[model samples]
Target: MRFNTAPAPHLAPTASTRRIMQWVLVAMAPGIAAQLWQFGPGVLINLALAIATALLTESAMLRLRAQPSRAGLSDWSAVLTAALLAVSLPPIAPWWISVFGALFAIVIGKQLYGGLGYNPFNPAMVGYAVLLISFPKPMTAWLPPTDLAATPLGLLDAWSAIAHRAGPAGSSFDALAMATPLDTLKTQLGLGRTMDEVQSGPLFGALAGKGWQWVNLGYLAGGLWLLRRGLIAWQIPAGFLAALGGLSLGFYLLEPQTYPTPLFHLFAGATMLGAFFIATDPVTASTTPKGRLIYGALIGGLVFVIRSWGGYPDGVAFAVLLLNLAAPTIDHYTRPRVYGHPG
Candidate 1:
């Protein structure tokens, strides 16, 4: 008997890359709006600068590589990368900072390795990590949340601060600047302060820091929207949050004086953003279902370790990059057995 030999199990149609990226961008809107509401026009200004720079850089790189820029530009990957990097940056960061980061993200992080799907690391996180390491002071100089500021910063003030690195009249940079919740916690812990005493300050809010909880909630909401729309896989965020919460809870329970609560870790800094947006990058994240779980758990564990013990206050960028490097290996070992085949 003659048997027809052909590829088995044809997959059904799925969303196009452009559509997926569009959904991702839509999901980011709430988080961006929250940042704008909480911080001021700096968020918008930074995003504008980053997006402009990213598009320019992407165009230049595509031209140099002799690839058509139309599809690349239309994909919205570069725009999303710029947006993520902008959000990671300090609200009042100089224009040059945004320009440099966006250019690097597109040209070096994405295009250098043949663009998009070929890049092994999360391009936005790579840009963020480089800026953090190279320009430590500027990168770490976050503005005081609006509610916590003695004088709430206006759009004009944010513009001036970014333009010339100066706050409004009668206000020094020191007056406008405040350490992030993670940074404050690390500093206070280094100074032998207990968790309770550290959190008693006005910096601490109902859960995380002032304004930050709302920001985190906004991201969480957006992330849930993405999940509901099937834009992202569920395993990664689930594993990430579970592992992080478990580790943090254990530490807090063991020594409440020394460790902050799991909820604080969950709602503070960039935890939600990193878990939902950064670590779920389809190009760089583990592809297999089981691999994704392992990848996310690794990132989560590393984040807790670095936040608690390492030099950096928040380790989202570092953790994501590290796990990105391991994604291929994770995928290799976690591949599911073919149907009707032996494991």
Candidate 2:
């Protein structure tokens, strides 16, 4: 009798990667629904493009490497990577943006490092970082909330905007696009405006930004379910949110006029998604329990620092990538004690 061998970076000893990826995809449904309601059909468009591109790219790469495409394509890792990257993108970005980003993610970020569990960085984040660096304008070309846009985009309108790289007929891209809440706040504070003044602006919402609070809530709900299902560990998200919220609270209390509130930080920009979905990536994240907390807290700290001082508005992707490099060190120092061994 012969047993088949598989690749590295498996989610767990008990769970197959396909099942884990399925749960993750299911977990994102509510968030995707929120995105559609708030931002229009851009998420779906990007997701379609990314999923297609990632699958094809991964298939080709597998064949080139003489690996079985059936084993890989069935695992759903590529699909999960694409979904994460797709949702992170500007909803109405050019069609090529998703295609190119997904290609790079599967080709370089994952396969180049020998695929799946062997890759140190999160493939989705690697794609996002490259896109942000190479195509900053398109990456940041975000549509305002459905209620805020001059013309609300239907499915065909979204398809048109993505394909043509402009807004619907008679509307300019400028009418549809706006800076995200994090960006707006960063710019306003730089201009010496008070937080109150900024919060009263059209883009600001009750908790975070218009449409953003609900989206975060949607993801938060799914994340909690994931926690309950034991698909993900509790330490990572807890430490991440706790540290981010703690830091935001300290700064907001110190200078309420200068900083956005903890609620804003928690609900705006990719805080919940990054904390729950992205940081909980088993392959790239810390393996040891204590290390997971430290890893998460450090990522949270980096996110705050980058948002406040770094060039980017949101720092989740960069924060995750940075710590991906440090995961080994963290796990080394945080390893649990051996039951029978003592110093």
Candidate 3:
């Protein structure tokens, strides 16, 4: 008896990589708008600069690697990476900051490791982490929300601050900037202040931080849009938020004076963006349904641990990078059984 040896038929999905990336860009619009409203035009400028730098670096690396530069560049992966890195940085971060970040992300973080899919870490997070570590003062000098700023930075002032390295009247960017809620909380808590005291600080506001709360809300809206469009699976974000919220609630219930509430944990930092977008990167994240839940939950749990006890005020980048390292292991164990396979 002769047996037929034929390849399995390919099943078509409604979306392509390009389409997915386009949707990702569209989903970022609400967040981008919020940043613009709260922070001024600096955010848009940084995004443009970062995107240009990323495409240039991506093309250069692809050519050097003897790959098709146009094809690689057209995929918009580098653009997305640049956008994420840019948005995460202080809006008025010096020009070189975005430039160096784009270069590091495209070259060392992505290409040097054998290009996009082969890299173990998320390129954008790698770039952000490096910049944060190297330029702590500049990176942490986030602008107080428009309502809190003694002098809201105008377009020209913002431009001058970022471009000329000085604010109006010889003041520095530092004079016009304030700490993020996470940074504020970390320092105050380290100084033995209670959670209530920290929440009442100048940096804190009705929702969370002066301006950061609006930014987080913007990202939250954008993330919800992404979910509505089905660009991402609900498993990762749902699992991550559930874990983070549950853990924070447990801690808060155990000691209200010491621990921040779930709202603070959810809206204070990069929790929403990380949960909906960053942690759900299909390439770097787990693929199987079960694996995705495990991956997301692990990230959320790690985020709580890091925020509560670790050095970093915000744990999104650290948590995502750590979980990226374990994705393969997660996939191995969580693989779904074949339909006809015997258990």
TM-score, model 2 to reference: 0.95
Model 3 scores a TM of 0.94
What's the TM-score of each model vs. the native? 0.95, 0.95, 0.94
In candidate 3, which residue pairs get closer than 3 Å at backbone N, Cα or C atoms, i.e. clash? Answer: none
Better of 2 and 3 by lDDT: 2
Candidate 2 residue spans exceeding 4 A from truth: 1-14
Flag regions of model 3 displaced more than 4 Å: 1-13
Model 1: which residue pairs collide? none
Question: Considering TM-score, which of the candidate structures 1 and 3 is the better prediction for this target?
Answer: 1
Give the worst 10-residue stretch by lDDT in candidate 1: 5-14
- RMSD, each candidate, Å? 3.0, 3.6, 3.0
**Residues 1-343 of candidate 2: C-alpha lDDT, one tens digit per residue:** 9988778866557877899999999999999899999999988999999999999999999999999999999999999999999999989999999999999999999998999999999999999999999999888878889768766799988898899866687677667778898999998889999999989999988889988899999999999999999999999999999999999999989988988899999999999999999999999999899999999999999999999899999999999999999999999999888999983
Q: Cα deviation of 50 in candidate 1 (Å)? A: 0.5
lDDT of each: 0.91, 0.93, 0.86
Candidate 1: residue 219 lDDT (0-100): 93
RMSD of 2: 3.6
Ranking by lDDT: 2, 1, 3
lDDT of 3 by residue, 259-299 (tens): 88888888888888799879988889988999999999999
